[model samples]
Target: MTEASREVGVVLRRRPVDNPWIDHLWSPAMILDEVPATAPWTVLSTQADATIYYAGPASIELFSSDTANYRDNLADGEPRIWVALRRQDGGSELELTKVTVDPTEGEAMFESGCDVIGTVPMPPEIAAWIAAFVDEFHVERVFHKRKRDRAPGDRRGIPDEGKRRT
Candidate 1:
């Protein structure tokens, strides 16, 4: 467990949905502080609404540049860990793609339209771990707004406005 990275086990839930095109929906169910002896993709449990499977292990990577995002997450009343699962080609199996504590990186994962991305409550153990990293690496950035350089008369990018050039 180094300062820059931490490994955690993830379990995913496959809930049956009413949608005719899909059989089930995949989402991160929970994160485990301890790596379970259970095999990846092995069914852990089944309930009326969903079935849980071990989605294997993932690493939460921290960067000194990203400490601000981590701090914001810690300040959030309900801190969450972002999890992403990628499909195993055109099949039902899901691969645990990424796990992250930084909110900015987490939201960026959603830009990939094909992956199953979701957030799970940040485990207390993991939250403390991230908080420790932030305390050590967080650097306060002073925002310095820069004035745009432009000719005073130039209001638009167009060379000439309101008149057509014949």
Candidate 2:
């Protein structure tokens, strides 16, 4: 099957954790609420929401087009940034979380599990600010609830831990 056919109507899954590396990435985003009104995106299917950090440097990009309305057919209605998360296991089911681009706050809130994780996807120009935020603020510790397994096939066996052992 082609790449498009491989990703038909699929969603990623997410869990919560207090010591998420993403805390650094999303915090500054919240300060300015720098939500991209319009841009293209490349979805990196990973194991759970917390694993987003593993997507590596510059893994997060602007969404240039609507990604097949992955947000419960709400992509067209007040579009927001969407990320896919899945379990560590190679399951076929996942969760779709939306973060509203707060033009005022400079960050996006993870609406699904707002209490757990908030992410900020910003342009590269703001890289320096993001760095300072990390250096200035002490990373808070958090605990996230484990998500139940959905239908199989949503996960792609992507390791969330720092290293990928064979």
- Whose lDDT is greatest here? 1
Q: For model 2, how does the per-residue alpha-carbon lDDT over 84-129 read when each residue is reduced to its tens digit?
A: 3332344432223333222222133433333334333433334333
Candidate 2: worst 10 consecutive residues by lDDT?
Answer: 1-10
Best candidate per TM-score, number? 1
TM-score of 1: 0.85
User: Model 2 off-target regions past 4 Å?
Assistant: 1-93, 103-116, 124-166
Deviation from native of the Cα of residue 58 in model 1, angstroms: 0.5
Error of 2 at 71 (Å): 25
